[model samples]
Target: MSDLIELRDRMRAFTEERDWAQFHDPKSLILALVGEVGELAELFQWLPADSAAARVQDEPLRSRVGEEMADVLLYLVRLADVLEIDLGDAAMRKLSGSASRFPPDDVRGQAPEKA
Candidate 1:
């Protein structure tokens, strides 16, 4: 199985073990995801674009950033699991749609048209 699938399964088991499925409805998961994203964003909130990249070189900040990123990913995977969504397939389908909407040759070096 793919790593993401394995990770999703692991997340499912973890949630089941905690009996937390009751708290994992789509709306709650989405809110939790937003919170995680906010935490991740906070890490780079005031940094200049260049400095934001450099900030990851600092071990403590890097660790926090990594944790926040993991939280975001875990919540996303769990949400997908709870919703019975195949994230990999969904991502590919989205990518295909995006490719059709914004063909590389047509959109290269240009901003995408507002949908």
Candidate 2:
């Protein structure tokens, strides 16, 4: 099975074991995902944007960042599964759409146009 599918299954089992499936509706999952993203953002909120990458590489911060990111991914996967959305396919299609909208030869080193 794909890693994403495995992860989704694991998350499902986790929720099921805790009898949390009732609370895993799309809206609640989305809110949980957003809260996780906020936690991740909070870790970098006071850092110099340019140094943020290096800052997260340190030992304690690195572990903290990883945990926050994993939380975000878990909630996102749970949300996608609840919604019956194919996250991998959706990601590929979105990437392709973005590529077509901003061809590299034409838009290199520039911000994407407002859609």
Candidate 3:
């Protein structure tokens, strides 16, 4: 099975074991994901832009950032699982659509326009 499917199964089992399925609805999982992203953002909120990248590469901060990112991924996977969506396939289609919309020859080195 794909890694995403394996992760989804693991997360589902974890939630089931915790009796947390009631709280794993789409809205709740999305909200949890946002909170995790906020936590991840908080790590860089006060950093100097020039040093931000380097700082996250260091000791404790790197681990913290990784944990927060993992949280975000887990919540997102749980959300997709609950919604019966294939996260990887959806991501691939979205990426393919974007590639067609923003051809490299046409949009290279340029920021994408707001829809």
- Largest TM-score belongs to which candidate? 2
TM-score sort, best first: 2, 3, 1
Instruction: Estimate, for each residue in 1-115, the C-alpha lDDT of model 2 and write its tens digit.
Output: 8899999999999999999999998889988999999999999999999999998889899999999999999999999999999998899899999889988898998887673
TM-score of each: 0.91, 0.95, 0.95
lDDT (tens digit, per residue) of candidate 1 on 1-115? 9988999989989989999999999999999999999999998988889788887989999899999999999999989998999999999999898989998888899987673
TM-score between candidate 2 and the true structure: 0.95
Model 3 reaches what TM-score against the true structure?
0.95
lDDT of each: 0.92, 0.92, 0.93
The most accurate candidate by lDDT is 3
Mark the 10 consecutive residues where model 3 has the least summed lDDT: 106-115
Candidate 1 clashes between residue pairs 3 or more apart in a chain or in different chains? none
The superposed Cα distance between candidate 3 and the true structure at residue 19, in angstroms, equals 1.1
Error of 2 at 103 (Å): 0.5
The regions of model 2 sitting more than 4 angstroms off are none
Cα RMSD of predicted structure 3: 1.2
